[model samples]
Target chain A: MIEICEVGPRDGLQNECKIVPTAQKVELINKLIEAGIRNIEAVSFVNPKVVPPMADAEEVLKSLPKRDDVRFGGLVLSRSGLERALKTNVDFLHVVTTTSDSFNLRNAKRTVDQAVGELSLVINEGTASGKGVAGVLGTAFGCPFEGEVPLENVLKVAEKFLEAGCTEITLADTTGMANPNQVQEVVNSFLDTFGKDLSLGLHFHNTRGLGLANVLAGYQAGVRRFDSSIAGLGGCPFAPKAVGNVCTEDMINMFHGMGIDTDTDLASILETAKWMETVMERPLDGMLLKAGIV
Target chain B: MIEICEVGPRDGLQNECKIVPTAQKVELINKLIEAGIRNIEAVSFVNPKVVPPMADAEEVLKSLPKRDDVRFGGLVLSRSGLERALKTNVDFLHVVTTTSDSFNLRNAKRTVDQAVGELSLVINEGTASGKGVAGVLGTAFGCPFEGEVPLENVLKVAEKFLEAGCTEITLADTTGMANPNQVQEVVNSFLDTFGKDLSLGLHFHNTRGLGLANVLAGYQAGVRRFDSSIAGLGGCPFAPKAVGNVCTEDMINMFHGMGIDTDTDLASILETAKWMETVMERPLDGMLLKAGIV
Candidate 1:
């Protein structure tokens, strides 16, 4: 069985031009939970001036119905974001940094080393507060400014996160520049170095239309957890020419069609994605929504 | 190295509302040849009333540059279509039928067995006339109306094609309902039943967003020849909710990105796809065209 972490409300909506209402964000999360999504990155605790769509992260978190079966997460890029998230009832803190110094400087206003040092402290603090802290290495595959990121750089960050008491880590193809060969290589290296017990996840964007292919490669390489957005809603606001994330319903449809158990309902997720299309008031980047599940 | 047969002229433009000029079709073929594409399905010899975009099949074939390095194919559905193709300077005749009876009936106005019986005669005639006859089995994966097409049905069609002296066989996912597991299974089955010397190609649609993933799976399963369209332009006009074929430049980008060679120029293909977008007067379904080659 593969584990899917729904990132629709947070990562999906962060780059949208329209500011979705707090109620709609909460409602989308509820719909995902109803669709059997247990792990969700529901909101990001960032400044309203930077990402206005996530202005109500605390409100959205507070409004969500408490369920033992569900775990809601919030993205924290800096100490200020962590401070805001620690005060909320977020089930997990998605501590993020990138391998490219330029991307990290632009996104978090700090260098990669600086961001890593601060995030290590944040991870310790969040874990002490009884919240699961997951370290997300952005641009782990390649960076727009740096072109091809070194695999050693990605592994170095994962080691630091593991040392900082992070039980889970996610490697993000922030720019959607990853290929299947690279995905297989990275997944195999992680498993080889981390001894196959590390709880690893993969986050991908469909910017170049290789998202699901990379997901298939990762699954073949022994990685189980994946991050996807409803209606393919997300893109990196800081990355140039970035598009939506790997879609939730389409990825689910592929897994189910292949007889791989994702343990999520495809029909229910498709319904949520259709509802999200109306909320966004435009045609999103999902394919299964247009071509119904086979 | 993988062989890609460019199908932008026949399959891509067949379903378009606009009728592309014969001269422009010749120009697109010339552009693809300059980009190192050797095999191209330039035109389909069908009734103009059914597919208006391909009304000038003879005109397009006559205008193309007669280069020995390039092999241009024309789609032939019936004896009349084959007669039309044999009169032209087309290098190959792509004789086609489907695995599903409903699709074959709708597409060729004959049952699968009847279509096969007729196409076997067409193949023998084309071979006697010194033209390469490649058999294309449509809906070999699944049909929009018939749900799931059995593997035995697919194999039976291939056997008939081989017995009729077709050296090349293409398994087409006419409705885009194929999964990776199915692709691997079918490719393995075909290679196991026939010898490794058989020339097998895979054609896929991006209807459900599994086009490239399916391509990867097929490549991993040892099939080298693939059919793709410039700017991802083609869909089955008769199939409900069918979308575009796999994008040429994106697939090339994937193979080249993974250190696999297609021997096609990425920059040239992207320029052609962009030009095709202008020719179609709309944004096509291609991703690398929008995202640029990474």
Candidate 2:
């Protein structure tokens, strides 16, 4: 069995040029919950001035279906964001930093070490505040400004998060640059080092059509949790003309078809993708929505 | 090393609502050849009334850049089509028949057995005239009209073709219904049955986003040749909203990135894909074109 954390509401919506209404975002979350997605990245607690799209993160969280089983999380960039997330009822907090120093400075406005230091406090304080903390290493595969990201750099950041009491660590292909071989190599190293102490998740972008193949590699590497978005939303701003995260429905269909237990209903996810299309009033980047589960 | 027979000219253009002029088709072929593709399915000899897009097969064949190293073939549906191909100076002839009775009857106006019998004549005539002959088993994975295609039925057709002097057989996923397991099973069976006598090629559609995965499966099962299209053009007419064949550039990038040698220039293919996009006046269904080589 695998756990898929629906990041459509957070990572997906963040990249959209058109701002979706708070109510529709809540409805999307409710629909995903109805489709058996209990683990969700519901919001990003970043400054509204920086990313106006996520300004309504608090309202979206408040309006979501209150279920004991459904665990919502907010992605945080700094200590303030983490403090803000601790005030909310969200069950978890995800602190993110890039592996490349150049990308770390450009994306987060902080050096890799500074961001890692900030995330360590986020992890320590959030855990003390009775909330599970997840450490996300973005650009772990490759960086847009800096071409290749060293695997050792990614591993060091992840080790810091693990040492700082992070419950889970997510290795993210922020630039859509990770291939199956590289994904397997990184995932295997993480499992070998921190598999006993920390749970691992993989976040991928479908920009190069290797997203699901990377997922298959991760599965083979004994990592079960993945991050996906409905309609493959969240276009990459750094990479011009890049597509979004892996389509949630397409991943589920492939996994279920492969005889792996995804436990997520594909039909329901398709319906939510349909709703997402309608709300966005545009065609989204997805395979299952276009192909209709053949 | 793997052999990629680009089918962009015949299969990719057959489904286009707009007819690509004969000169443009030849240009596409020339561009593909310049990118290191030696084997190309350059034309189709079906009746112009049935598929008007391929009406200029004779003209296109006449205008092709004749080279000894580059092998071009025409797809023939019936014995008359085969006769037409024989009239041309092409290197090979590919005769096709579907495994599913309903699809065969509807597409070719003949039952599976009747089409196979007719194609046997195609193979005999083409091989007798010193041209390499190939038999393509369409719907070898599954049929849209009929749910599942038995592996025995597909192999039976393949056996008839092999006995009829076909040196190559292509198992085509006509409706994009094949999963990786199915691809592995079918390729394994073909390798087991005609290990010494024949080479096998696998064709796929990207409708379910499993095209690359299927290719990976076929590779693991000991098959090396594959059929792909530039820009992922040519939608399936039977399967509603079905996408096109796997994009040739994307497949090459994947195989080459995974330490498999394709010997094709990635930059040159991307240039051809760009030219194709200009000719079609629309963006194509390819990932590498959007996200340039990382």
Candidate 3:
């Protein structure tokens, strides 16, 4: 039971400009279901004017394929944003904060303490509504503006997320600057501290080509759930000239080849990603989508 | 002791269409030497027509700066090629063989056994001539033609190279398909078997963007020497689809940032790489060359 949570519809769409028609967004999510991805991040409930790419989140949710077995999630950055997500039928609400002070200020327009406070509120509201809550800590490894984030800072952030009633915590290498050793040590530290209090997940970028290595480190450190974008779409607009997320098909191919059970059809994911690329009208940075995963 | 071994004049040139002027190759090597790269791989002694990019190897060598600290080496694939190298005034000679049968066949047109026989003869000649000898085990991690090369096979080849009286061995991720775990395991096994009877080095490709990961893995496993081309030059003509060696500037940037001492100045190496790029009239693949590692 390998869990691969597709973040393309939310993370990928939000990062780039080529906006897909709301109906086509539903088609892509439905196609992912047809290809057997059970856990897909469908969209985000942010301001339409700010992140124009995800303006049709409500429409995208209304047109889903209606599978009880599959769980759909949406990303949210603030408590007010959670109101929009609560209106939809998303199975989980994902919230993100950063370990670095500068990144939090730059990306979320809040200090780390402020962002964590907001996340706690979102967690309380989501649990009250009987929905899953996920906490994503961005720039957990290193930050471009501020180099070498301390391990203690990350631990404190994770502790805050878990204490705030987050069912799951995702450590994101947001800047794609994490090395293998750092990934192993940080993930292991979290596991040792929290154990079953939270389910751990990884979100990595392929910026310096360390995505697979970081994922391997996370795997060795006992992480099973991960967030990947189809065709490696979605760079942080916050990051200056950043690359996309780890390619979904390539990640699946590597995991499957290593006898890891990732319930993903690599070929079908490629086909769906290709369709997204056609609609986007720009080259999405996914390798397996183009290379076809030998 | 930071040892920067420039492989651009050889590795970078061997895979290109435009033949760099012999004087420019010599100038590039001299500039690297002035910039404090002590060990520079001068050129490869191979058939000129087979690789038109390296056709002026002898002329290029003749024009190199005369410096006692800067030692020059040449790459050769067979006994005959090593014999050709013996005619040059190179400080060292690098002999290459592949642990993977398919890669060895395609790269050098010889089986492992045949390559070993040639290695023994060349080692003897190299030792008698009082020149340093290094053996490069190409595709030590994974092969493009045949993937998932075993650690046992690579270790066995290393044992043979040590037995042939070679002093140094370079474990090459020839296709850049190695993960950090694989690198650590292979390097650990090599260190266990060789026990410093031979020095261990790494040659990596950024094809899959695991170059730095592999390098870090090797370092943790106790390897010190590494081969890198300026601007990440010189793909395998046989495997042109794959990326080439790790960029010298990028490696230096990582090591220097980590407080590890590399004798080469990153800025100077970058400047020399830029000059080489202009001389070769092609795009250089090294990220630091473009990104300017802040």
Candidate 4:
């Protein structure tokens, strides 16, 4: 079965208005469980006022039903957040850094050396606890502030994370500024360096409408795991007009059309996406949501 | 220097509701030329009644100034259209075919073999007279009617056209069904097969918004020549719901951002795009038109 990591709760809710109640977050999680999503990003333990959407992360985590098959994860920006996630009995923690030096400084409030140092700390902490850790290289494609990030910059971040014991690494087209050639070059470089030791995944936004194409590029470059939000729900709040993530249902449909077996029910996912749209009170970025699975 | 090919006259008008006046079409061509478009596809020679937008093809061709640097080409669908183009002083003719059987039948009303046969006649007649003949493979990336056009299918068409003495073959992501992987796979195949006997170009739509990404992929595969419409104008009249082509301005921005010069004026082309948008009475598909070149 093709790996589908549902990032709706973390990446999805982080961009929305009308902060979902903790119980409703639980309801969403329960629904995802019912839908058989094996890997779910439960919440981001960030400041409630900063991201009003995910303010109730602790309550949501507490309300989750412990299932055998599903793995729970959280998105964390710093060591303090990672520590919070470690205490919650989660399976994974996603630590993010920007590949572009300017973006890294602006987004993370640190230089490359500072961000790399923090990543090493988080990776070490997760490994010591016997939990999987993932490093997400934000702005892996291109940067709004910096523009056209060199491939070597992404490679450097990946090398630092891997050296610090990151078991999984995801390259993010954070601003939807990445094209497929850049995706191929970065992915191919990682593969050349780490091979099977690194579990490579992709995080894409449809800012310029390249979400699905970039994912396809990743798949072609031998990445088996992907992160997508239902209804293409989220954008970066800090990243200045960042677009939605790759639509989960559309990605599944494309995969299914290609005879690649992704263990996702497109019909059910589409229905969930409709629910998301109603909750967010916004139009979704997913094409299949409107066109249906053709 | 960016190579700006004005596809607005062909693609931008083809999708409009009102039939563009013959004089307006000529004015648009003149404006694009004034904006410094060295290569322009003047108009298409198809059934006038079927595509009323292109009904005044002969008049439009006649209206253009006889400039050595500015190329005038017509999109030809059949042998009759090529015959008509031959009668005119068109510098070149662009013949297209769909890689998928369904799209070929639906769009061109002929099977691939039959379309190739028709294309061969045009190539033979046009090239023998020292006028350039080019083939554009529609749905080279993916088909809206039939999803996932096989590489073998595109390769077969390219081989047929190359053997028939076509000067260039452009892989078109008609309906924006192309991804970077598909773009690279198809373009690499052409390079491996025909080498330098035929030049490879890419034409992509921004429907699913991989247009620029697909171009990047083609570039990585050693394809230097590319086809883009100004202000992202132009979708196939056959593909009723297809999105616009890759924006000429955006592609130029990408090239300039990457330190590659295409020898075209981006700011002036954008001004021309804005003027054309006013004439067309609609918003263009080009993002750079709204976002401006950063």
Residue-pair clashes per candidate, as listed?
0, 0, 2, 8
Work out the TM-score per prediction: 0.98, 0.96, 0.88, 0.79
Off by over 4 Å in 1: A235-240, B235-240
Best by lDDT: 1
Q: Could you tell which candidate, 1 or 4, scores higher by TM-score?
A: 1
As a whole number from 0 to 100, the lDDT of residue A117 in candidate 3 is 84
True contacts kept of 3: 0.08
Candidate 4 residue pairs in backbone clash: B1-B262, B1-B263, B1-B264, B2-B262, B2-B263, B2-B264, B11-B234, B12-B234
lDDT digits (tens) for residues B1-294 of candidate 1: 999999988898986666788888989999999999999999999888877788898888878898998999999988999899889999999999999999878877889999999999999999999999999999999998888989998899999988998989999999889999999999999999997889999999998999999999999999999999999986444454768889899999999999998888999999999999898887788888768878
Every model's DockQ: 0.72, 0.59, 0.25, 0.17
Among the numbered candidates, top TM-score falls to 1
DockQ category of candidate 3:
acceptable
lDDT of 4 at A74: 82
Evaluated on CA atoms against the true complex, candidate 1 attains a DockQ of 0.72
Descending-DockQ candidate ranking: 1, 2, 3, 4
lDDT against true structure, model 3: 0.78
Candidate No. with top DockQ: 1
Candidates by lDDT, descending order? 1, 2, 3, 4
CAPRI verdict (incorrect, acceptable, medium, high) for model 2: medium
Error of 1 at B230 (Å): 0.4
